[model samples]
Target chain A: MSLAGTGPRRDGPARGRPRSEAVERAIVEGVMKLLEDGVPLAELSIERIARTAGVGKAAIYRRWTGKEQLFVDVMRAAEPPDPELPGTSMRDDLVVLLESLRLRGLAGRTSAILHNVRAQMKSSPRLWTAYHDTVIQPRRRVGLDVLRRGRDNGELRADVDLELLNDMVVGPVLVRTVLRPDAELPADLAERVVDTLLQGLRPS
Target chain B: MSLAGTGPRRDGPARGRPRSEAVERAIVEGVMKLLEDGVPLAELSIERIARTAGVGKAAIYRRWTGKEQLFVDVMRAAEPPDPELPGTSMRDDLVVLLESLRLRGLAGRTSAILHNVRAQMKSSPRLWTAYHDTVIQPRRRVGLDVLRRGRDNGELRADVDLELLNDMVVGPVLVRTVLRPDAELPADLAERVVDTLLQGLRPS
Candidate 1:
């Protein structure tokens, strides 16, 4: 159940004229690498990352309150900004959008970060809200945009609730991937999802 | 966060001569009681249940392999047998069908068992599958049957894949209930859900 995170705490602050930006980048990259490789946070020690990153552990702690905070950034690192795409065709747009989710889910780095996010969300509502603001909202807006576009394009009948559609696109895959790791992904799941959604969303 | 059946074990055997059927029934009821109360498993130990059920710990262990197994049974206990209602009308039938789910999710006993069920699904596939067979499949059949009825009745368009409709019906509520434990039941959530599904399931 334990997944890797940024790592353990360091006691001292960085005592130099200036900390190198390269070191900061290396710390994040090193943590991401460890997590992707299935390193458990229990074993993802700061000492291990320092050795890997060639950066002092003390410098890592100087910049962050804890491993969780650093991992929050790690989770937000490469996520797509929006859930939908604006384009000529709604179906084609959604196909690309959902495919992005599929690609991200298939990636070891993204899945690990998502798992960590779920774990953190359980204990920290404040962190959850913050992550929602910094991490989840932009993605939500994209989904909203796609539905709005779909209606305008006549691809979808009007009278559809865009907000509800936005929830549908993200909620299922997110739950299936993050909550049920072993859930089967049909080869045409994205197409089927969009098709089914459009069926409901079509204006009467 | 804790919406489903993660609270206390309910499947273990109760002690006494010939494993009194009456007392075992009482034990199951006791488990449901604790769940409705929002009691965590950590606090709702076997000792408390035994005392509450007036049974011995040996009895509880004899029935279930452990606390987890007990809770699994307690959970499966609440899932209703699939309804055999046969009719062509999807709307009337669905109203009957979804009411069962709402009763379960909104009711104290059922919701508690579900809370524990969700927490454990990711941890143990074996238990989860068993729980599904014992719990979910029964509930699932209700939706599947409704779709069949919808197709037979002129109300639903022909050529609709009932399986997808099945997912459409149950998946969203589950997503809402699990992701946001405090999610308000929108005044029209049920009607909207049925309407939306009908719109999708309708023939082109």
Candidate 2:
């Protein structure tokens, strides 16, 4: 399955040349696949992935530090935020980010990784802590940007609390994805959430 | 620990009395203590509990089916929802629910149970489906009710989309609690979320 491409075999074709990319991609893909299939990461293992991906162990270790690093990296790959979209209106920007889920499976990836991350945190507290500060915090900053822009623009009321609004945006998405994979996230949820944040829930 | 306070005591005096509620309470209390002290539930064997509780295995099993069933029941003991606060105001009602985390450790006990549940979901499809439909749905319904109420009272704009609002509320909470346990659910976070739902997040 290592489609290293059918490049011209220059000189004497090497027999069983190392499928280095196959090994890395396979391991990472295997992790994503298991999670997407709802296999919790705690139950995931190189042995199982080897069986699933038909890749060798030596090949996987050659690239990844271990399961932890590999898992974190795989999660990171799924959430590629657009820095270009920021410095704009918060409502418009968040809608763009939130809509990406429909196209790129962001909600699915986020929900899937969560099970794995949760299991890892329970077993390895120190490692999980470091990962959050380094990995998770950076992602959350995207939400922070939206809030800042909203507050700056009169779209959000001048006195709006950024942190609380951040939670509001994040809480529902996190909760919905984890709780019910089948639940739908509409294209307009972000807009409704932002509107509520600025205007208040009371009728005008 | 088996607090066989109700069981017949074979010792001296009226020790042949049935086990007392005090003894049972002591056993459960000991279990919670060990848990808080970082003792793994897997290590909390009946023998260990009985030894710690000064009771018999008979006393423990007499009350519980087995360790897993018993443990599941124990974890299910998250705090019940508080009495509905009297108010037409959404913010006040939410304060009651969000503050209930300390009252129930949405990030603590529920977290632990969810950890175990995620791990076990791999082996038991039935349990996973049951939890998804039962426990998770019930909680999500609470958030949905808030949305529906906002719409009905016109507290939310007539054109507001409720489904999106529900997701906004649930997603972030799960992400915060499951992914980042140390952060407290901020006091004003609910307000921000509610605000976002009603007003658009934009620079007015």
Candidate 1: which stretches are off by over 4 Å?
Answer: A1-22, A34-51, A57-66, A77-86, A108-129, A152-155, A171-181, A200-204, B1-22, B32-48, B56-69, B76-88, B99-127, B200-204
How do the residues A55-141 of candidate 2 rate in per-residue lDDT, one tens digit apiece?
776555555546666655665554554345654566668766555434334444556465455555556765575456556575578
Residue B121 error, candidate 1, Å: 6.4
Question: Looking at every candidate separately, what fraction of the true A–B Cα contacts under 8 Å does it contain?
Answer: 0.22, 0.80
Docking verdict class for candidate 1: acceptable
lDDT of 1 at B173: 60
RMSD of each: 7.3, 8.6
User: B144-168 in candidate 1: lDDT tens per residue?
Assistant: 8767766675566676566655655
Q: Rate the local accuracy (lDDT) of all candidates.
A: 0.61, 0.56
Model 2, range B34-65, lDDT digits (tens) per residue? Answer: 66566766578988887777888877666655
| Candidate 2: regions farther than 4 A off | A1-75, A78-88, A101-135, A179-182, A186-200, B1-24, B34-39, B43-69, B76-84, B87-89, B102-154, B157-164, B170-175, B184-204
- DockQ, Cα level, model 2: 0.42
DockQ for model 1 equals 0.26
In candidate 2, position B29 carries an lDDT of: 59
Error of 2 at A115 (Å): 7.3
The whole-model C-alpha lDDT of candidate 2 against the native structure comes to 0.56
